[model samples]
Target: MESIKASLPDVIQQRIEDLVNAQTTDEEMAAHIKELGCRIAALEALAPEEKGEEAGQLGEAVHRLCERIRRDYVAIAYRQGLVDGMRMDKLAAEE
Candidate 1:
């Protein structure tokens, strides 16, 4: 896991570190972490078990870390009106 962390993209690692260091309300943080855990678990459950065990493990870890950062920071930002929500309807209309 240490080696895996070392190999992650700098931007991703920095984001994770930022999340770990952030000072946010506990309720918000807990909700974000819970969302991240659910997302990671769903992804892991969908992954096939037979091929490239190491790759699967690495992918799962990355997914988990990314989810954590996104949930903690991105979600909070969206909720606080700092970041805009996804406009799926606009995207569909464009297509």
Candidate 2:
């Protein structure tokens, strides 16, 4: 969680704010996940399969890092759905 904050505190903060302030539905989260998958695919395509190249290795590392972030976002979005389903949002609010 600290690593995530260090990397994208703004994004995470904005997402949480959005979830709390608006009707962020599960459908929207699913679409974001699908879009991330498409973006990852395109990124992987740009990094050729050849080995021993420093750039490709760096790109692969970055790809994995991005995948991790995307997974975290998915979890966040799913939890938002759960909170809404339970009506927990009513108990929580941002000032």
Candidate 3:
């Protein structure tokens, strides 16, 4: 519990966890997650500058977070594409 909260601030982590545990469609969850990522990115960009090693650490953390978010977005897009393709195929078969 403390470790989880340490990794991410309590509020942010809790909100994300809530979204994950919610009874919602994958597309809806992905959209909300993307929105949350955008908000976090904006906040990071506006954060006050740090010095020396601290700045480097912050940069690394941001880089890793961006990569994770990008990967997740790609996965969501791929899944959505597959769903759309399947729907199209079904419609064509009915036609």
Candidate 4:
């Protein structure tokens, strides 16, 4: 949705593009993205009368999805030795 695009932070937009273009055998990233999309769609499907808490829950779901993507990105980067410093605590923080 255009509104959704407008609402997203630029960093998040870039991250989504990066994830889509990333070269890897793992299908989990794509699957996770798909699941997030589905959750967003479900949120959109909610009745107009049922807006507050349902929307909040959906927001949290999206946050969790973003966190997962970040974790996976960090893990893959660490595995490839792309970055010099790898900390278990950083990865654990995502959970």
Candidate 5:
């Protein structure tokens, strides 16, 4: 695992540190993401339609941010699952 990680890019290393190492469960993350989406929608709703393209751009940018976060989380979950599976396999072998 260390060898595999060492070969990856520095950005991925940061992601593992920032996300995969977190103690949060998948459900908690999903809920948090849902909340963020709701907040985004609420903020967009508050923007005056008369303000025109700027408000739309802001909403689109925020939405993209959320989507990026969600995508990272999917990668995090997959890596975590792989680690969990490795642990289980090790335990089974020991038995």
Candidate 6:
């Protein structure tokens, strides 16, 4: 995770840290995570396509990190949705 963080663009890294630390609502956090995933995917796509051992290794590293972050974001969104649904159901029951 540290290696992944180290490779991230500085602005992205800072934004991620801020989001994690802030007292944000679940919807906001989930939205930010999805946005981060999209930004990372765009960056990965825009990276210069090079052919070499070093380039191959770097590409693999970036790919792995991007996938990991995307998966994490999906998990967060799923959990948030589940919790929100449960809360709604409970509120409906009370009414």
Which candidate number has the best lDDT?
5
Error of 5 at 25 (Å): 13
Candidate number that wins on lDDT, 2 or 6: 6
What is the Cα-based lDDT of residue 44 in candidate 3?
60
Better of 2 and 5 by lDDT: 5
Model 1 residue 57 lDDT score: 72
lDDT values, one for every candidate: 0.59, 0.61, 0.62, 0.62, 0.69, 0.62
Local accuracy of candidate 4 as per-residue lDDT tens digits, 1-95: 44334434553565577768776445876786678777676776663656857786776777687878788878876664433123333434444
Candidate 5: worst 10 consecutive residues by lDDT?
A: 2-11
Tens digit per residue, CA lDDT, model 5, 1-95? 55444434554566568667675577886887788778767776788877646766776798788779778977877897687567556655555
- lDDT (Cα, tens digit) per residue for candidate 1, span 1-95: 44334434653565577668767668876786777667656666676776456555766788677668767776665554422113333333445
Clashing pairs in 4: none
**If both were scored by lDDT, which would come out higher, candidate 1 or candidate 5?**
5
Candidate 1 error regions (>4 Å): 1-23, 51-56, 63-95
Query: How much is 20 displaced in model 4, in angstroms?
Result: 19
TM-scores, all models, native as reference:
0.34, 0.38, 0.40, 0.36, 0.45, 0.41
What would you estimate as the lDDT of candidate 4?
Answer: 0.62
What would the C-alpha RMSD of candidate 6 be, to one decimal place?
Answer: 16.2
**Which candidate, 1 or 6, has the higher lDDT?**
6
Write the residue-wise lDDT of candidate 3 on 1-95 in tens digits: 44443433654555577557755567875786677667656666666665445555665677678668777866886776676566556655555
Q: Candidate 6 versus the native: TM-score?
A: 0.41
**Cα lDDT of model 2 by residue, 48-68, tens digit:** 567336555565676678668
Q: Tell me the TM-score of model 5.
A: 0.45
Residue 27 error for model 6, in Å?
23
